[model samples]
Target: MAKLPTARIDKLLSSMGYGSRREMAALAKAGGIKLDGQALADVSDRIALNPDLPQRMRVAGKALDPLQGLVLMLNKPLGMTCSHKEEGALVYEVLPERWRRRDPMISTIGRLDKQTSGLLLMTDDGALLHRVISPKMHVTKSYLATLDRDLRGDEGAMFASGEMMLEGETKPLEPAVLEVISERQARLTVTEGRYHQVRRMFAAVGNHVTALHRESMGRLHLPEGLDPGQTKLLDADEIALIFA
Candidate 1:
């Protein structure tokens, strides 16, 4: 396991919704917080410098255990919705309770729709989510789409130039990269993620996307051996790929 870095005790706890740092400090002042079986004297006191060394912390008669902020790449299966609504099977239900409990806000990096599947990343880190999903960063997402018919005409050129008009959007979409993978399939690369974008792009060209499977986001690709509905924690190097 990788070592968890050190930070202020109250700040860490507050990030986990324990309370604000000042509030936690006041609680410490009231003798409600304990460290190693003694009343904590300083809110600034830091423990957990090493993930190997377990630190005992308690508040309001309950232990305060911090998660290491796990990032998981899930191979989303069909019939799942990433959101919490009951419109379909909740995607986070596929995660173990341990990961789902990181916070109520753990979310998929980008949505894969109810029927589209593959390469969904889930995490509790708000900073990581914003950095990866922000449109200004130009991070590329790649997908393999099965279409209703063979691609024809200057679809590739059209996608490359951002010449196609999507409905109800004021600005033309940023250019997409489309390639013919087979008679009924093609690979697409795009930076911006409008609603049902790959399907819409194909529809604009008079073809229909019958199936869509995202292959990669930035440098992170779904490993072939990973099966649908399975998840694996992303290592440090793999997490770095989100910003690449």
Candidate 2:
């Protein structure tokens, strides 16, 4: 069997944003770090780093946080910027403050403008983030759009033609699916994450999206009970659905 990865307890704790290395030493002295039900005598002790660590390790009397490859599914709220530096409300504010400090910080896989809301993904796994966002993956994203005016019946055909090109864009968009819910509301599914693509698509046909909310990415839909601004850690099965 392969040797399990190992790291100094203080280093691991600090990397997880529990505290700085010096702080971890103090925490260990105060009986705030434990492994396998025993308080650690030294913060410098080496420990196996594996999936089971969360269950076997305790920090400040609580189970350790999820390990490095964390993925989160969030119900994005309107008016929240998906940026870390922009002003006003930020999506990261909904997460535990310490998570923002994690080494290899969590970042949204793709962005949603402040005006849009719905299913959004964040991950610390850089490869996974890039895989889902890669154009070659063609991961489908579904959106529900409330429009400013009635739909012209041709909107669906136009979108599905694979010939639609947003203004100022050189390449045609891949064929998209548009399911009309009403004269003024529609659900659109797209494979590309171009800047404001959904909104731009509507504008191309002389209509405007009054409200836009993402409903799904591939087979993963936003949980109906997940309120705006709330988040859930995606498990292995849920993560697989994005590639399904």
- Please report, in order, the local distance difference test score of every candidate based on alpha carbons: 0.82, 0.94
For model 2, the stretches where C-alpha displacement exceeds 4 angstroms are none
Q: If scored against the real structure, what TM-score would every candidate get? A: 0.76, 0.98
Q: What TM-score does candidate 2 reach?
A: 0.98
Compared with the true structure, what per-residue lDDT tens digits does model 1 show for residues 19-59? 67898899989888886788886989886655432347678
Colliding residue pairs in candidate 1: none
Top candidate, metric lDDT: 2
Scored by lDDT, model 1 comes in at 0.82
